[model samples]
Target: MLKKSDYRVVRALGHGSFGSVFQITEIASGKQLVWKRMTIVNDEDRKMALSEAEILQNNKSDYLVEYYGQFEDESEFYILMEYCEKGDLRKYINHLRELKAITSEDMLLDIFAQLTEAIFSLHSANIIHRDLKPENVFMTDNFIIKLGDLGMARVIMGTQQHLSRIGGTIQYFPPELLIQIEESEIAKTDLRPQEPVIQTKQCDMFSLGVIIYELITLKHPFADQNGEVLRTNIIKCKPNPLPNNTPESLKQLIMQLLCKDPTQRPSIQKNKKEKHQKKNKIKNQKKKNKKEKNQKKNKKEKHQKNKKEKHQKKNKKEKNKKNKKEKQQKKNKVKNQQKKNNNEKHQKKNKKEKHQKLNKEEKNQKKNKKEKHQKKNQKEKQQKKKNNKGKHQKKNKKEKQQKNKKEKHQKKKKKEKNQKNKNGKQQKKNKVKNQKKNNNKEKHQKKEEEEEKKEDEKKEEEEKKEKKKDHKDKKEDKDKKEDKDKKDKHHKEKGKDESSEEDKKGQVQHDKNKEKKEHHKEKDGKGEEKKEEKDKDEHHKDKKKEEKKKDKKHEDDKDKGKKDHHKKEEDKKDHHKKDEDKKDHHKKEEGEKKVETEKKEDKKEDKKEDKKEHHKKDEEKKEEEKKKDHSKKEEEKKDEKKKDHKDKKEDKKEEEKKDHSKKDEKKDHKDKKDKDEKKEEGEKKDDKKDHHKKDEKKEKEDKKGKKKEKGDDSDKGEEKSPNVVQAQDIKGDA
Candidate 1:
């Protein structure tokens, strides 16, 4: 049955646990309306919606979304509202995420202006938007921002009244609301809870602060680890500092809005007056000071001109004296340089003479040492030749006597030679054996030394590797710290740039105002100059007329001398009066002109200020664009840094992997060398055992067949004693 109506419910726009918003189209107008449907149709909810509708119906504003009508269906109650095509601010913020760009300041300012206007209107009507957030504010396709959601609004009057239940998202709750609730709960325990104190306009201002903070930073001011943490932090801890990039004006405004004490928050009227008065006072004082300074400077210049001629002669005398002094100083400087050069040349000559004398003394000492060494060598050679001549004759006589005795002793000598040869062979064997032992010991020592050297080299390499790793780690840490510092500095610079731009804009406006004032003054000066010229012309004409009258009276001077004199005196008095009147008129005209010029200048200043404001708006728009560009660049830089860091991390990982592989290779090489050394030691032990067994067999053969039994018995005895003692004795004999 409802399908045949003029309005058609297209779809649900939004839904909550107890209420839902439907997008409906009117068949006649083809316009859409958002229908908020409440399922739990209690008396309280109905009254709340009715009050909101009443407020909206009576208060008409461009900043506020219009309310249509409230109706009821079979199962639900529907409150109709103006359809905003662009939806709420929350959706817009989310949409911007896809674009990955922040909203411009112009858009923010537009929103703030509209919201402020709406708030002012609401306050005028004694209504406060207890819950004000982005979700409650809607925007149209044409960039019109409208405040909506009056479900939590309260009407303030003589008697404080509050809705029994608080309604708002926990995230956007102002500090006052929490305080009110706490106070109410305490009152309840004390049995004095007559009624909860009502919230004021300041509460809405607090919510506005949160919204502004969110808009500027693109994040909640009180966000924490999670929802619970956020609530705790908001209730207990102070909000974190806003981003350094936030504009100073916006930051200051938001801070004012966020004042925890309602009494401390800025009043709308007070803020406006303060800002305007400060601007006006600054402008006025600048103009007044400039005019006064100009007048003083003109007076000073006239006085200076009068004294200038009297000082000319003195100035000329001073100039001549200064020229003479400069020339004399230059001559003295030249003489000083000449003296320095002469001293330097004399010092150089003295140093050269000393160096030549030292070289001659060194050559003389070398010649004396050579002569002494040659004398000693000649004396020693003469003594040795004398001793050799005396010994030669005695050696020849002994040789002849020994030759006669040689035949008889020949046989005995041959036996002795045979025995000596055997002994010599034994000694040669012993020497060879000792040499082999020494060579073995030296080889072992060399091996040990080589092992120790290799160990030391490995330790040194390990230390070097550790130092390099530590250096690399420190460098990486320093780079990270530097990068962080650079980012902080860049953020601070961006903030300074924005503030400087604002200051420059303000200065430019002031300059334009000053120029307008100067232009007005110049026009006034020109007018005064014209008036002065006209007065001079009138005085000349009056003088001309009086001269003609005096000429006519000269003919009757004898007959009417006394009358003529009295008439002349009266005429002179009248002329003086006329001159005085003219002077008075001129003064009045100048004063009037000054007053009119001041008024005109004021108006011009106002107009100029308007234009400057418009220009400032344009500048602000440009600044918004600049800010967006800066944010984009910063984001790009952040991305680049992130990429660089990631690359560094990957490179570090690769380096670590390479180090691990190198460590594995070193361990494997060390293990292989250790195993080879152990194998060589085993072979040496086996060779020693074989040499011992051979020596034992030789001992048995040398004992002969008769004593073989005794040797075998001894061997058996040695074998029975222990292999260690027998091996030690055999190694010692070898």
Candidate 2:
């Protein structure tokens, strides 16, 4: 019933019908706890869980494990209990095997007593521990027993004799239940009467019997090859044979608890609890007796301790006095020894000083005698040096003359040898110089040939450039001619419009002259009747003539603007042509400068060749007299180097040939590129021209559209003009 979230799970201890048992820590208090988790998936499970929790919560005994709390969640319920440091009885029983199995009987009886007591308490509370096994019995670090895992426990009515339901581990099953299981299997086959088997308190005692035997012997009481064989043995009511060394009392207790008949099996009434009480009583008696004996021993130890203390104190006091006296005597002796040592040291130092003074005087006398001896030795050495100096000077003069004669003889011999070999050396030097000069000439000739080839290549390249330029220029010229033709055609069309305009002007003038003549006649007849009407008519005709003159002036202004625009365009084209021609002239100048630079470079190379030839001749003359490291191997290496150079030169020539071919291809590409560029430029120019022409046409169209609108407005204005004529007529009437 514990809240699972309230504890941090340390590790899982085990899992069974109730989900699992975990060693955990309570979060709030840092208390270690055990969680028995059981999922309450349905009301029946919930009810069973509540019953188990109730049985745990209501029960209280040192022999029975304590329940701390419980809680339920949506999916599961948890029962929190005291955490047993030592895990369970089964593990401890297994450990008994290593500790000597025979030593386990006493421990087993104690644990068995506790288990039986816990079961008695459960039975008294109308609860049956259906699954009593060694694993369900927990132990503490102090070897305290705790009965746990009441998950299979059931509550019974007060008058109920036993539980008729099946539960518990097979190995721990009582003989009665084994027989019942066998009977149930037979009943299923309709081979026997169907009798309900019930779990009484004897079942738990039987389990305790098994736990006891297992702890003492380190195995199950009815152990076989497997649970099934054990089950068959259990159904036959065949119990495990006890060893001969097993205590009679302990063996008898286990045998009686595991009796095949529940009626014959001893309940908690007179078995474990009574034995526990008797054991406790004996233990109390033993403790009392031990305490009495301990008290007597303490009194005797105290007297002995006091006597030893007094003797030690007497010895320490006398020893202290003796040590004091000894220390004084020793100190006095040390002082006397120090006085004696000081005296001796003083005597030794005085004698040493006296001896040192005597030695100094003796040393002084020896020094004077040595000085006299040294002075005499110095005079003798000076006399000897004077004698040896004369001998040394005469010997050096003879040796100097001998060396000079030898040097002169060697110089003459060298001069004669030089004279004898001079012609041969000169001939060899000339030959070496000639060879060097020939090598230089060959190198210079090859350089000149290469330079000539480079010049030829340059000429070819320049020719190709010129051809491409010419081709592009031709295409540009053609495009320009086509544009010129288009412009001329437009001009011819404009001329026709001008002639038509002249005819329209002539017709307008003739109409105006006729109107003037009519008006003059009207003026001539103004003296007659209806004079106002005549004046109105003449005024209207003059107004019409003025309107015609205004429209004609607008048309003439538009034509003048068009002509000025065309002239500006022609000037721009001429300026573009001049720019292109200037670019061509600059390019030609650059090409000529490049050619001149090539000639200058060739002349410089020739001068370098002449200097190198002179240098080579001088070097060869010097090299002929010097030892050179040239050998046949060196000659072979040089030949290899020459071949490599030749191969490189051939590769370079091939590459240059390919480059020349590529250059031809590139020139063709450049011609195409130039033609493309020229065409694009021409097209761009044409587009600009066409755009301008379109704009002009658009403007003309806009004008014509405006003229149409104007014509309509003119009709309106003309209609209104009649009103002006009427006004004039009105004036005439006035």
Candidate 3:
């Protein structure tokens, strides 16, 4: 269906030993793509070249290069794939190295993430990208990676391990693969039957680790020497440490990926999941930081507002004192004028000097009293200002200490959260590894058990068939013998002596009774065997049902666990929302209370200090009442939540009980039906046995009647001459 004429080659992209890649454009849509042309020399070469196209066609992923089509000519196999214009990761790494610059941690992590996704996609499809290297990874213009060059990738089925093959870059080969290769060669000399097979994905993981290490430090993690030295180094030597500048987490991840044992390497899915979790955590942290910043800003604004209110209050107090002093001075000046007028009137009537002397004395006394009052007022104002300043300073200090303590608490919480996350991740990794191992082991065991069961059943059925055939043959022989004996007895009764004929008749009757008894015994034995077989079959069926039920319960438990986890997360988010809402409400209420207090202070400005104090007390009482109400509401909400939780738990328990009861009922019904059917079958068998016994008895009675008739005929023959009878018997016997 594919034709090479549909695509026109633009330019050669790269060349390899077995293949060459070229940039190409489609004639129909003018879409550009990469054409990989492998020079096939034989059938094996062609098949190997076609494997990549087959794998890509069957499996598709966004991170991996897209497959378009494949075609082959006489000598070359051509496969078309998506074209990446920005070149490969190796070139990018080289360019960075040439510029003497280290790749940013974010960019490295992004590349690693993209590569992981691509690998995970391939792995999920059961295709191992054995040739994972920087050269195989291509970048788009936006720096997104597309994994290509899956020429060496192999698709494995089930849990089977692949044999070590000569593919992929030697520098990137994992220690396990390297050991497998060496052991394979050694096995030839040692005459060993099988060499250890390593997981192909781990080989890819090792390559990925090397690529990451190179990206970060622009150097290989392992020795890169030629020949045996490199092989030995890869097999035994540890990788070099990453640069100090690399993040601790990244360093740890790389080290784990480079572990010697294939089983120890972290799975790509785990890494992908962890990456997603990390991104979610980062986003949540950013949101929390923004909320905290907003809260801090609000606190600062409130503090500044409170400072401004205190400053305004101080100015108002100073201005009120100035006004009071001005009013007192004006009253004193008026009183002085009145006193002078009185003194002038008195001086005119009497002595002017006495009046002037009294006026002067009064003026001196008034001046002294005014001076003392001013000094007392100044001292009280100063003391009040000092007390207010001390209170403000104490409040600021307390706020600072609280802020510092909160910061410390937040830091500790973050540290604990990170530690818990780390521990959880490790536990999950171990759990997954253990689960995978157990599942694989169980699968293999189940397969073996099923095979053995099938074989045993086949053998049993074959044996039963052979036994049945033998039984049928014996029954046919017995039937023929009985017929021959009846004929002989008839002949004997016709011509033999009466006594001898009678004796022969009795012996035949006795043998017939014994044969019938034996036949009945065989039938009984067969019925019991059939019943045993039926019981065994029923037991097997019940066991299968129980196994199915157990599997279902296990699945249900997993689902319930996941549901519970999600529910808990949702509850935590809800509580966080409620707490934030409460904080906002409290802030709003505090602002309103401050405004009300300020308005009360303004209204009571002309009143005595005691009135202001009483108003403050009333405001405090109102605030306490509002707090009590909020607390009561909170308590009620908690109680309701508890009731709801209890109800939900009870409902779940009831549902479980109902389900269990229903299952029990179903089982009981099935058992009853089986019992009824078995009883019916047993009754039918009893009836059949009764009918067979009756038929046998009837046959026995008929044979007895015939024998008696023969005996009577023999008696009549006995009355005649014995010589004639003997002659006739001899003739009949001959």
Best by lDDT: 3
| Residue-wise C-alpha lDDT for candidate 3, range 1-734, written one tens digit per residue | 88888889999988876699999987755567898999988888988888888988888866789898888887889998988878998899889978999888788887887788788888888888877878899987667678998887888778635664456766677776666554432211212225445556777888898888888888777644422226566677888777888889989999998888878988876655786785575457556756885787688778778988999999999999999999999978986775564444233323543476578668866975896688669757866875686578668756865786687679769967986998799799989999998797667556645754664575467447645754764575566567877764564344224323433443344334333333333334334355445445744664474355335434534534464457446755864675576557656766887898899897667556766786797679668856865786686568657755865786687569758867975796698558645643454454466567557655765666868877567556544644564356434323
Name the lDDT value of residue 635 in candidate 3: 69
Tell me each candidate's RMSD, in Å, in order: 58.6, 62.8, 67.4
Q: Give the per-residue lDDT digits (tens) of candidate 2, residues 1-734.
A: 34566779899999776578888987655667887888777898888888778888899876677788888777888888888889897787667667764645566666766676678778888788888877888987667678988877877787645645577776677776666554432211113215656777777878878777777667666656553334556667567778887789888988898777778887777566776785585467557756985887688678778988999999999999999999999978985775464454245434664686579758866976886588669757865875586567558756865786587679768966975698589789989999998797667556645754664475467447645754764575566567877765565466446544643554454344434433333333333234335545644664575346435534544545565457446755864675576557656766887898999999989978986996797578546523332453365567657755865786687568758866875786588558645543444454465467557655665666757876566556555754665466434323
- For candidate 3, the per-residue lDDT at 433 reads 95
lDDT, residue 733, model 3: 28
Cα TM-score per model: 0.34, 0.36, 0.35
lDDT of each: 0.65, 0.67, 0.70
Model 1 accuracy (lDDT, Cα): 0.65
Model 1 scores worst on lDDT over the 10 consecutive residues at 184-193
Question: What is the lDDT for 509 in model 2?
Answer: 46
Model 3: residues >4 Å from true position, as ranges? 180-199, 224-229, 271-734
